[model samples]
Target: MKNWFVALGGVLGYFALIFLYTLGAYLLVRSPPWFRYLFGFSSLSIFFGLLARTFHWASVAHIVLAESILIGGGTLFSLFWAFFSKKRPDPGGGAQRSPEERPGKSDSPATFLPAEGGDEEADLPVSRVREEIGTLLDAGLSVLVYGPTGSGKTSGVLMECLRERQAGDAERSILLISCSDGMEDYDLLNRPVPASPQEKARTLRAMAREHPDVRIGSLSRLFGDWDRAEGPLRSAFRRAAGGERLTIVFDELNRSSVSALNLILKVMDPVLGHYELFDFTTGERLSCPLDRLVFCATCNMGEGYGQTRELDWSLLDRFPGVVFMDYDARLEKQMLMDLGVPPDLAGRMVHVALALREAHRTGNLAAPLSTRHLKNWGRLVADGADPENIAPCLWVNRLVSHDRLGFPDKDQVHGIREVLGRTFRGGRKS
Candidate 1:
């Protein structure tokens, strides 16, 4: 009885020691490929060695000794093989497919790598503000289209005008200028003159000299000169007052410097019908064109993504027609579907975006997920990338999250994983 009990204890102890050793080995390596190889070879060796022991051809002590040695040896070989092995696939990151390797390239309605930039001008069909723009502008008010990036605010304005122009609305010209910091009067005006006052005078004079019929108006003529006649600053108003209707696009107004924006404010007073522009050379009242012109401005929230400045209430009051562009989950999903994103994956990506947006509502995120990100995810899906593998790259990394935004790195990652897991496979509805 004592001998049988001793043998039973010895057998259990030996098995426990071997299990502990294998578990410890795997935990130390903690690499999936290494663990796989280590366990594979070790298990096969142990199985063959145990078969010999079962046949009474080998002793239990010998079997244990041999199995331990084989597992240790397998562990070393696995480590060596793993060092040269390719990395395990990371579900949340990486560009696994190239442009040619991506599906539907030969017969698809879309060709885009999302997250890089505009998806063919915001996929114009889904735009909703076109019809309302004409009415808004006709009200004698400057219009402000405010929204997230890629919500199509700038494109909405231009596309509507382009369609009108193509349909023979040729009298009016649609001019677009992207606004940014340190934007000078020359860039805004698109004048044929240099930035320096000397160069500006020289260029204007040279042009006048070349055209013998033209008068190179004096500095006095363009300046307080303003009290006598309009200066060059009221350029837009001058055109408007001259009965030449124009649509001026102020793209990304928030990105412009305060001085640049203040320049716009001078000319954007609808009630006064004009703004006072100081002489570029003299810094005095140059001219005021009192004819109200069509001015359209697009604004992004600019909290995280770009350089932004708050607008003066006085300047903002000029635009009574303010439209907030919000992303439509349904429209976005439909867009991806039209672009050949499979229905199931498109639906999932949309849900993911919706979830991110909802999470933003809770103030967990500094920026809401843009429809642009959804399109990106859908593009990847259409290209045969798994959602789980692509979501981290397309979704989390795309967030405007940073330490300054109050979300720590771990928290941001955690939040992203929680949201993705719930929406993708955890069976939680967005």
Candidate 2:
């Protein structure tokens, strides 16, 4: 009975040491990939050392021999697990099939596998806000979509418009302008065009005949290049005025200059029904009617977006249809699975993203994991890259890079590492 109790005590003590070691490592360790082995080697060494001290079970030589034997066995098993275990297929579940293979399912994760010679664009992850945008466009109302980065505002809307345009009418014109801080009124309305040799000579002769007293320096005006070319905006306006269906998409509208915004406002004035495009070279204004025109703009308006202007309230009022897009958990997970990530793995990725987004909301994190990041992560994981190995490069560094406090917010980074360790531990292998 005494021997039995001593044996029980030994087992309990060893396990207790293991628990403490695991907890400490989890809380303190930065690199999780190597932490498990570190815990195992250190805990076994300590436990064996303690047993030898307390029970006088073995001499130093004997203890060293036992440790070597046990550690060698563990090392061999680890090698087997690393090199051979992965060759076997998963018994729990068969291979995942593409969405088209399974029908009557619209709500589940649609694993998109394009057929031979299939169109990949047709398989893009569908956004919920797309329907609303379509409804507004059909009603002849302009749309404004405001959302966080990577919420699929620009790509989703642009793809949907392009698809619709291709399917419905090839003659319908679509114009996409990615607005920037440097965008000016002239950049939108019109721009100078280099004059051809013949045109320049003709203009110079006509100017000389009309204003012979004009100085040689004033002859520079005879070059006549200003507003000779119509920009995307003007070209779309003219096409819409000519009874062709037109869709104009302005991406990152908040980044546009004040002059560009004012120009947009004037051009979208519904009461006027017709807007004038100035010909700077000829001093003429051509009136273009607004017919069959649909305008849409996307803006990123929140923290972590630098150099973005607060949109004018008047401009916001012009959009009869407004959508606030955000990351859709179900859709995002579906997208991951579609990219060939295991369902369980996809779920965990979405969970981490949601947790990070909450942290961002509370100002604990500078930015959250975006759909773009998740897609990239998913593709790598699907291709057999270890999630734990690539996470630091893909997810962790990205969050740390944008930390407003500094390049790496240590406290925040520690928190992120902890979250990742907790979530990714024992995760599905691929």
Q: What lDDT would each prediction earn against the true structure? A: 0.62, 0.70
TM of each candidate vs. truth:
0.52, 0.60
**TM-score of predicted model 1?**
0.52
For model 2, residues 1-430, the per-residue Cα lDDT tens digits are 9999999999999899779867777765564434456457756776877689679977878887877777777767666765575466544355543222323222111111122232323323355776777777766678898888897777855457556754776765677898999988787767666788777767777878888899645786645553266778877766666777777889999899998898888777765776555544346555655656677899998646888998888989878888888886777878889999988777777766776776776656667788889889999999998775688788776664443445685446656665565557633233
**Tens-digit lDDT string for candidate 1 (1-430):** 9999999999999999789877867675655767766766876887899798889978889888988898888877877777655455434465544322333322111111122222333422354655566667555456888877776567635456445643665566565667877666544543343256665566667666667675566532543111222323355545655666566778888778776777788667534534545545434443334433467788876555557777788878877788777775556777889878866556656666655665665555656667666777777778887776677666576563665566544445556665555445654322
lDDT of 1 at 197: 64
**lDDT score of model 2?**
0.70
Query: What is the RMSD, in Å, between candidate 2 and the native fold over all Cα?
Result: 17.8
Candidate with maximal lDDT: 2
Give me the runs in candidate 1 sitting further than 4 Å from their true place: 1-134, 138-140, 156-168, 190-243, 270-292, 302-306, 400-408, 426-430
Worst 10 residues of 2 by lDDT: 105-114
How well does candidate 1 match the true structure, expressed as C-alpha RMSD? 18.6
